[model samples]
Target: MTELQSTAFVSEDKFAVAQVALYILAVLQVVAAVMLATGGAPIPFPQQATAMQRLSGTVNAVVMVLAFAVVYCLLARCLRRPTKLVWRIALGTFLTNFGMVVLTMVAQPGPSPVLTGCLCFAGIVSVLRGCKSVKAYSHS
Candidate 1:
């Protein structure tokens, strides 16, 4: 094999863990989408949500779309090239998703506290994984 080809393969190894992190974030995004789409249950929201709350939901939806795009890009790059840039994208996705989760909890009622708590916990996982991936790639 050519030297450049061999070097490319070697460098790809550094990003294997990051690829896993990105895929995990993608799965979490899907989970969040399901929760938001289904309403998570039927939390009573006092006749109608206020304008601010409605705006928040709209924003959350937009964030989710962005998260999905990040996931797609990260996954594609990780699968195709496995570079540090892909890891950075995954980390960004995690932060965005976490922010959306927090916003949801603050702006809307969970079907129950338990559901919201579960989402928060999931968000924590994504954040932790993202951080770990960043550290791992940075060192490599």
Candidate 2:
């Protein structure tokens, strides 16, 4: 294959990896959201043992699920068309994941804090790689 064709192939592969990571992150977020809403061991630090807490937890859970759905849709689109819009969506996902890590650290200390932090970092790296791939492919 030509150099430009090779670059395009590599870009597609990178986007595939990123899409997989996004799906994994979405699943993780859904799990976390469930735990938050259920008053599980990993409940948020900002939460209290009150009706308000329960309500807030439910809201948080809903938001998490909705966010995951949106990300999944964006990932599908990105896979179909790896363009600027795709990179923007990936960046948004990275930022949102980062925000979740911060919120988790601030709201409560948990056994999985390290894991959560790592996951957020992974998301950031994946996003950066995907963006770079897109840029390289475009230039090629």
Best by lDDT: 2
By TM-score, the best candidate is: 2
Whole-model Cα lDDT per candidate?
0.55, 0.67
TM-score of 1: 0.39
Clashing pairs in 1: none
Instruction: Provide the TM-score for each candidate, comma-separated.
Output: 0.39, 0.57
Off by more than 4 A, model 2? 1-12, 36-64, 76-80, 136-140
Q: Write the per-residue lDDT of candidate 1 for residues 29-138, one digit (tens) a residue.
A: 56666666566523344557996786577567757755774755456465444335654554555466556667776887566334434544554464444555456656
After superposition, which runs of candidate 1 have C-alpha atoms over 4 Å from their true positions? 1-12, 41-47, 50-66, 69-79, 82-140
> What tens-digit string does per-residue lDDT give for candidate 2 at 1-140?
69999889765676665565566666766776676556663545453468777677678766867687666756755654577777777777667867877788788877566565665577567667767667776787
